[model samples]
Target: MEDAKLTPRKLATRIGVAPKTVERWLADAELLPHARNRVDACRALKVDEDMIWPKAVQERVKTGHDRELAHAYPYRSACPSTVWGELIAGASTDIFFAGYTNYFVWLEQAAFIETLRRKIVSGCRVRFLLGDPDGEVTRQREAIEDVALSVGTRIRISLEHLGRLGPLDGLETRFSSPEDAVNHVSLSVFRFDHDALVTPHLARLVGHDSPLLHLRRQGDSGMFDRFAEHAEELWDRGVPQTP
Candidate 1:
């Protein structure tokens, strides 16, 4: 039943929960999770309250949900039939692979870095394949190495040139050959479990749109598989070199 437009104090008493608790729940990052969960629970309990909620309260929730969706990354899987309904619950995870470095800086994404560190420290397999091996690239690599180490985590990289990439501090770097060759710009995909975020801005800004990395959409697993195969082949074919 919809709430009978009770005042905040009355609603709090009716629910046996504090007003602040209700307000906090409504303000949560993933707000609707509890609404949904509560709906189910109330149905099972056969309890119904006033069916009308105040228009203002409803408007607040609608606005909050819209803001979150516009700002957050999206992922949906048809095969799995699941959605990360962003309510007042919590944020979810995302995995990213980029051919250009600009996107990393573009998002001002300290969140991504921390998530990566958490995944590695928790024993999740993670790797970053940087594009091209040049002198300036080597220095940039060192900076990333320091960042990861400072957090007591490690990032494994498969450098295409140098012999068995180098071991910096405790991080492992190896030179790998082309696992496959391609004539187009591939994609930069960020995955969270069965979901992913794919964008072209990174490669576009850096001018790496060489058909081999044309990241666009994430709804196609077949396309993603093909990209992965090509990258692996190229890495396999590349010869090791030192910077």
Candidate 2:
């Protein structure tokens, strides 16, 4: 059977609604990627000036794709109340963090990071791969250094810089495919001691759990390997984003 293809307006007509309504869903919701193309086609199919959705509609769809990845990943949660539990309470997470002037920003999880620090104090093999340009990461590293200095041999840090890379995560993370979309997120990725992913987004930017998408299992194994290699390669490069 041929694939179903319909203009957003035609789809709206078939579904007995206004074209703008269709555009609304496309712009303001967690729509599938194909919906991206669909929205463009639909906008072009505008019956008249009144029928055309705002250009912002389609652009917002593109701009918000990063925020929409969470909807693609399946989220699992439990009442165990562990640091990981709260982070994964939804299906998937896409963290949008804005780094400071020139430092990486850890996804918004003060509680979880604090928990990880306790784990580190207990001799956990803690490794952090911070993006060099991120001011947040730089400040956070200073904070860690202060703690380490105070501890004075109680905790040992094994630091390896990954220079300046888009999106950051701790080591031991199984790197995945790059998001082939625009990203408004400042904080890219965060993991809890290499167990689960952590991402930070400004609350209320999107509705509750709106950007938290269920991720599809990747079909390309090579993509995963390439991603892993790229991350490791960057770590080896170790060119800081600053002078």
Candidate 3:
């Protein structure tokens, strides 16, 4: 108030409120400024409304129901199988999968593999970046899980399935290294065009037990862009499997 050259009486008079009300507002942090009060304060103080009332920032930023960060759906302690089918089947443009051992599950479903093949035939670019089973990062994760060779065995099985798809056009598969920070990743990302399903790894828990986030890009930024960039970085650094 001092910086704004505002005394209680001056601010109250400028906003057409009681000086007592201004005193109350100053005494209590929860006494938020009304919209009109904010406007009056901004003009009188020669400062932005946000500077006068910072709590209302989120209110101003949350433009639409689908446009905010809180719009992401959190699936806690559960990984639904149907989610994969729905996301993959509905994808029209592209599909990118980066996981520890996705093949052990995806390869078992003939329908899923066939659907991917169909998508490839339709000119959709499909990329997979799996963790290197023998990599140091994988070993560390195994220790965290307290399971010996659990991550490595899964990776090897996933690689076998990937090997079968090597001859197919529009399909790319590679293994990502954990040591390479630029390409090193800790989260599992399944991006299908504008929508992405993300699973952030929690300590001492495997991916399946971790919480999942269903994110839809409202515009060209936010969580979608961050995860997409990470996936792309990993993809660029991925080592291709030899035929």
Candidate 4:
């Protein structure tokens, strides 16, 4: 549109639509193209419909070489069970995390511990950076999320569940100290080898309500590298879980 030097009104005129319709399309990312509107817009812009719409690309992803390369979950509630299960189950090298409380959900699955144990035996290093249960940060988060269960209590629950692993050889858990720059964990990450599952925080919503971005480390510098770097920095300043 910029190359064509067409204003929104001009573009709408060329596409035979109202100028306001173009504004709405630009504002709402979730909006999909209509049957005739897509064709008209593409014809006017002199670009393929797929260039302006993601659904076109998404439909072909299953047949592509890198099927699980990248994904976007609109909301945490919309994520499928297979997404997390496969990401964790397929990790061959290492697993890293930066989360508030990591136990409530995972421990519910009977195979969660068994899976980690098997991964440890296979030489996958497991590292976790959790928020300090007693910190003011946790208190603030609990109040903000308005959950009946507090963040501090959740962390305590996580420790109890993790303790059941019984002196794992290649597992380490750390708590983020106030001094740590990444102590304010607005985003939670779970990186397994070349893939990372990231959930960034949204205002007035609990962690679980945020969307998840599934990133793969393929190119020289991508989302995976960026998130991995952030996780590593947090890990470096994290305090030992027991300490």
Q: Write the per-residue lDDT of candidate 2 for residues 96-118, one digit (tens) a residue.
A: 11111112122233444454444
State the lDDT of candidate 3 residue by residue for 1-243, as single tens digits.
Answer: 798788999989998999999899889876787888878878888898776578887675766644634333344335455666677878888998887666435644556667878899998998888887778877777777886548878878767766766668888888885555223435888888888888776777776666778777776667788888988877787788652
| Candidate 1: worst-modelled 10 consecutive residues by lDDT | 80-89
Candidate 3 Cα misplacement greater than 4 A, ranges: 1-79, 104-110, 181-185
lDDT (Cα, tens digit) per residue for candidate 4, span 86-149: 8888999898767767754574445777888898889999887888888877777878888777
Of the two candidates 2 and 3, the one with more favorable TM-score, higher being better, is 3
lDDT leader: 4
Model 1 regions lying over 4 Å from their true place: 1-96, 102-107, 111-115, 133-186, 201-243
- Distance from true position, residue 99, model 2, in Å? 8.8
When superposed on Cα atoms, how far off is each prediction in RMSD? 12.4, 15.5, 12.2, 10.4
**TM-score (C-alpha, index-matched) for candidate 3:** 0.66
Error of 4 at 185 (Å): 2.4
Ranking by TM-score: 4, 3, 1, 2
TM-score to true structure, per model: 0.34, 0.27, 0.66, 0.70
Local distance difference test, candidate 4: 0.77
Error of 4 at 156 (Å): 1.4
